[model samples]
Target: MSASAKKQSIYEPDQEGLYFPRPPVFSTVAEERQHRRERLAAVCRIFARYKFEYGFAGHVTVRDPEHPGLFWTNPFGMSMSRVKASDMILVDHVGKVVEGTWAVNQAGFVLHSAIHEENPDIIASCHAHTVNGMAWAALGRPLDPITQTACGFFGHQAVITEEAGAVVVERGAGFAVAKAFGDSKVAIHQNHGLFSVGRHSIDEAAWWFIALERACEIQLKAEATGSPLKLVAPEKAAHSAKHLATPFMGWLHFQPIYDWIIRTDPDLVD
Candidate 1:
């Protein structure tokens, strides 16, 4: 189909600005939890497929709708490839496991809990120790708006070197990380990895992290050639970032990915 024809078929062409149908809106916390769980499980599979899994040294979370003080996360020591919606655990701010049979990772809880607590507007957060993310983060720099995808991070990312390599067992370390993030949705934790926030849903958080990883890979390769990098114009980059790099867009982009995962591995919904 032609581009204009595809747009004509969208549910709300001017409103949503894409070919996707309207997503299922939830009416209750129970419905929201089920939705979040499905997305979280699919996120793990996507992470694993892209080699974002790193010996259980990562986490992603969404605040529990019914229990605001608690959030859901992957089980400690579980392989991202094996994680399922049923295996995710709910944990309180103090790192105590509130539900499920798995234990919580103190560092995961510490880092993510601080962000969730400090930024009430954020709904989800993602973290992982990926190769490109670590390489770019080691330079303690934010992503340059070198490509269209990179612009999603134009002014929406930061670098955090505070307490590098420090285990986040204490709430203080987590708070420091949160403070470093400030108003941005992403942070390059020097010598650690990347962390991205979702203002609305797990889909947004997961997609941003995935895109950030690829963007970092692109930036690293471009820097290695010793050639001066050509970046997008600042004004244009900012404009695109605002319009194309939205929470709803993030959610929309992940729909096909979730569909494919469900088709190949239906157990993720369990």
Candidate 2:
């Protein structure tokens, strides 16, 4: 079908925009849409606050509960700090664009779609190229859980030694990433970057990244000191993870950082 015909069939075209007149309008329902908008905005703001975003690169995806095969993801070419709910695109499980105008990042779909497809428990996925996270990714050694903060990923870190280009472009890349993850929550894509999966929001991944980064930084500093590195016991690490981790704590830690993003660049909300 022609572009104009397709638009005419599904929506009323106007200067204001294509309108879905039959879509339900609700007072409280609008509040939910606004909440989704703010949550997406919060993700962008947090990325900006930590400088985790690299221009239009990297993205976060959240699954639509009603549509198991569909998800909401940041639009391609949009800065993480500038993302809005209206800017998110709904994509099918195979990475096909189902709604919204912007394109989806192929790399993001390569990694996120299979994870979402295979792991029903994972409601969200966040991928990034932060300085420390990327640095750790390049290291031959994985991030050692030396501190309490790092214990969140105590037993969940996996290293992917496969060529980065291979995973990004190949059809089996998603399966490769999923294999590397195994039963883990975090995967260290050696020489690439960090990826974290969780129940919802980018908040969990953000916390994991920050904690892992700090752990790596401390390990480096301790190495330079020429002192024997103190390590947490395996049992203790497990205990801490079970007792300390919650979606609430994840949001708490990143909200202040996001506040910084909001204050410094309020235009990000636009």
Model number with the top lDDT: 1
Q: Model 1 clash pairs?
A: none
> Which portions of model 2 miss their true places by more than 4 Å?
1-34, 163-167, 255-270
On residues 1-270, what C-alpha lDDT tens digit does candidate 1 reach at each position? 334553322333454345544457889979999888878888988899889988888888998888888898999999989889999899998988979998988877899999999898888999999999988878887888999899988888989988786777789888998888888888899888899988988888888898999999999999999999998999999987886577777777777888888888898898
lDDT of 2 by residue, 89-192 (tens): 88987778998899998876878887787787776777877777777777756766677777767777777776553447554777667666776667778877
For each candidate, what is the lDDT? 0.86, 0.68
Question: Which candidate has the highest TM-score of all?
Answer: 1
RMSD of each: 3.7, 13.4
What local lDDT does model 2 show for residue 48? Answer: 70
| Candidate 1 similarity to native, TM-score | 0.92
